[model samples]
Target chain A: MASRAAVKTVIMVAAVALAAATGLAGAGARAADADAVRRGEYLFNAAGCLGCHTDEKGGGKPLAGGRALATPFGTFYPPNITPDPEHGIGRWSDADFIRAFREGRAPDGSYLYPAFPYPSYTRMTDRDLLDLKAYLFSREPVAAANRPHDLSMPFSWRFLLAGWQWLYFDTRGPRPDDPAKPPEWNRGRYVVDALGHCGECHTPRTTFGGMEADRYLAGNPKGPNGDKVPNITPQPRFGIGGWTPGDITLLLETGLTPEGDVVGNAMAEVVRNSTSKLTADDRAAVAAYLQSLPPIGPPP
Target chain B: MDSRVVNALAAGSVAAFLYLGFGGLGAAATDGDPAALVKQREQTMKSMGGGLQTIAKFVKGEAGSAADVQAAVAAITEASSKDPAVVFPQGTAIGTADSDAKPELWQNWPKAVEYWNGLKPATAKLTEAANAGDRAQIAQALQGVSKACANCHEDFRQKKQ
Candidate 1:
């Protein structure tokens, strides 16, 4: 009779002390460091992970998977990245996470399907990957069950992914910024090239699924629903070269084109979930970065 | 005269003229070959599509409430496809908008039929929803019909900017 009540009190006090010590309760309100995590948080938001990883269940359960990404390649069921040790990335090592984010290689060295958009991810620098992990790990973990992907047989072979990576692997990381550019512009460039991975759909692909770097951001016919993902590079005719940086920022915030048409396919989802959540200044920064790229006209 | 009687008499006179009024002029005006027959049917549908657009604009403007929407939808339904030949011609699957419908629609006829037939049913639901005086139902029906239009367009019409 004495043991039961005493045990419960001790447990409750222990939990309270742990919560206060770890600062876990206030994680959402607090943006730690505004230094490293700030950069990582910016990278994550730009990458649009919250869009793809979370269907964002009622009241906004981030990283609880239900978002479906379809491309001509195949449907990729993005895994739950919540810090659940069993269903999410809680157990993933820094190396494993870096490999996945930077090289499109999974924790087990299997080539991650391109649906993960590793082509654009290959541009991420080592520092970028590390910071992203810190930001992600610091987040409050929501334990949601992972959904198994419904890929057909040829795609179901996870080991074959190794060979696919060997053919298309690009792990050199993003190129160093042109030294003449301002630091903010360089930061914006780093966000887009490595973490944002904008090219996975916008860039043209070779027969075997490698990015056609020269044709970067040119329109692609085989988009999420076969709706064209129009060129973002500054080609006046077919690309977004004509859009002012403000126009680009507006598109990110509202999913509406500068001309006021809404994006319908995969882009709409990105705008709805991730970009719309960014600060106006961040959206402008991303716009500025994209505007810097050379124009690549629509695919021939 | 009744409308039927007038139409019959007019048809007879036009035929008689085509037969005897001129030489190659009659044949040129009326294609006699099978290939040309299909083209004629599609041309007729296209010719009538303008009427649909005009009526659609009128109905869209008139629709501020549920009852008004029902009447508008009823008008649009008849315009969309009071007759089958308007939407699904034998030769082309260009749908309501274009004349040169592609062959893929017929190649994949079953799925294409699903898309084409859904238009009338969806439009009818819209009319019913409007009559029911439920703004939400009417909106749902409108969206449903629009989706059908997009589906058929994606399948049959050539991509244009």
Candidate 2:
């Protein structure tokens, strides 16, 4: 009886090993699909596409793109980015989508306004953009009509944006990282400069609505709606130089400042829909990158 | 303008200045000093903000004891219980240097008062949750408190540049 039991146990162990080997191969394929969607979702949130596109104030569908962005140039409405064939990106080939994201050119070859933030999105890697596309394609498509932007006179001419782009836009992706820098810092650089686009709000703009690269992350006095977006540089009095990485992580997670201030402006919306959903590791990366920025004084 | 008459007039002006500057006009000084009132209320608001941060630290499991949560909740409740009408005296609105309070706050005074009044129950719920050490309850109550603040600030508080 003991000999029979030992033989049966050996057979059971062999069968289990065989099943494990077979399952591992299938898991690899499944993991790729799952992983792409996950990464894309992260990019979507980090890029802040939904904040301007979605009509959250009107309880409209996500990415349907009806919210009006008030700018010095005019009020520009974001277009529907859902996968609907007629109304969204459903008809867009991968190349067309890439052109729009990287060059701010639509499938129809019209120049996209800078309000779409392609200047920052242009710095993203092709692989990351593809992953983001995969995630966007997986969403439910809404058939919302794209709204026309309300701009005055010459600003309404989309061709004028080409001149603006010539002055400010850099079509290249981020430069290769310094070999001496840690891999984590490089990763943080990619996330902060490209995907996160923190400088869009933090950096003051030039007279023609271009970023003032000299005072990067120094704060904008003429931010949207005439509100002063505080300087975030490490300046002692005006900037966040005093904030520790943990303090920043907490702010991203819970919208609570180290000084006990609850963010109530556009940042509150960002916290609710974007940064708060990011993983702790991603938040830490953001903190690391922000801390590395050159300390600059507030706008004069 | 005789010498004696001029001397009496100078003495009277000095007496009035001392009366107003010192504790002579006590009730009027307390209500009339808008800068002092604004400063006091701002300090109270800061204390409330600190309390919320402490509670959040506990909720995130970052650090802080249960006692700390209770203490924070107590501070919030104490700060929020003050009457908004008394705290926000007249002449504290827009154009006051360093004052972020908008004139719309005084225009829509009743609704403004309601926003502060709404915090009482929200903080009460927070106190109960903090004492019970229920993280979910505390988070929900915190959201309520945050909403109350946002609702008021959206209309009343001027955004700082």
Candidate 3:
């Protein structure tokens, strides 16, 4: 091993260089970066962003993409989300970031497919988006090249997404909320129901791409990785309605379920990336908000 | 955790892999060379011993608890069955883990006759424990049996990823 002094010297140099580059960059200065970074990291995993976007678990490098996300239409290669300007999201401006997430548009005004889960992200508030953007910008830029989606013809066309979005997508802002809910609870609801979009997997989907909001999280048998995503709603049978907030919290902190089982799949990646590191309070808030949803069964 | 199921799966998969991937592994112990096959059996026994020893160390003192007993028992039974010829040596009693085999059992092989003589008693002991239905006794017996299995793993088996 290198001497301790050598390691310290390298760390100090890197820290100083980072200070020089991002020291007074005003974007992240609105709030201390640490909180936003923490929240972004949590939401990213909660959103299952890396689970599909990165083939990190099975001997692949983290966030250096190339996982094939299979949809009925075809398989789409989730891009490397590293901060690399050429191939990743490094150069995205705040508006560009918001638009990509909230509007499903790329930096160059191209529309990204809902497969990126922008449908869930669209519910995100401006602050949450900024925080997520802040976290993404703070990361190391990995220079892995991109791969084109192996989509079949017609579905591969970029313009087709525009018409598809018109039918299945909702570009409208999240509904104005009750003032009674505490700010953090509201924030949790926003992230879970919207930007974080836990329901995309937990909730059943319509034959078209839209979610079955009426049923809300009874369970989605068809998950992004093809594993069954169980219900988080208050249904005692097919859902987590039986789980206490602590049960959910433990599940988030560790890959192990309350039943003393740990599964290997998309969820394992999600736990490794996001939820495991979340602050107790944030995870609790998410649990509280989810449990409060109307107790319901999966879509018939 | 349903460690019983996991143990079955682990042992079954290994047996299956050896059977499917290559013919040599699942074949009868008598099929291979006289000396090399004996050495290979010894190696597997040693590795099993080491694995048991490590877990035994963890479960023995402050770290040991009621939770691990069932798992330990299942693991020991699984290992003992897979290679009883090497795992069980001569001169042991029924329902006992090791049954007082020669102290240098690791150093010597008492041949197929001695091997069957040693393992028959241990297997019988395991059968008794299984039938007793006393959870605590079962667990205690398992720990004892597993201690012997660990020694085998340490000496005889190859490490799998």
A149-206 per-residue lDDT for model 3 (tens digits):
8887788898888887887777886657769887667867875777556777777776
Instruction: Give the per-residue lDDT of model 2 (tens digit) for A25-98.
Output: 78997798789988999889988778888998679899988678888888988899899998999988888888
DockQ of each two-chain model: 0.04, 0.25, 0.03
Clashes of each: 3, 2, 29
Give the lDDT of residue B75 in candidate 2. 95
TM-score preference between candidates 2 and 3, better one: 2
Model 3 TM-score on chain A:
0.79
lDDT of 1: 0.65
In candidate 3, position A201 carries an lDDT of 75
True contacts kept of 2: 0.32
- Model 2, residue A128: displacement in angstroms? 1.9
Residue A101 CA displacement from its true place in model 3, Å:
0.6
Could you give candidate 2's per-residue lDDT for residues B53-142 as a string of tens digits?
898777667889879989999999999998898678788886665678888888989988998898898899899988888888887787
Report the Cα lDDT for candidate 3.
Answer: 0.62
Stretches off by above 4 angstroms in model 3 are: A1-48, A58-61, A174-177, A182-184, B1-161
RMSD score of candidate 3 (Å): 17.7
Which has the higher lDDT value, candidate number 1 or candidate number 3? Answer: 1
lDDT of 1 by residue, A135-173 (tens): 787788877787777776677787877777777766676
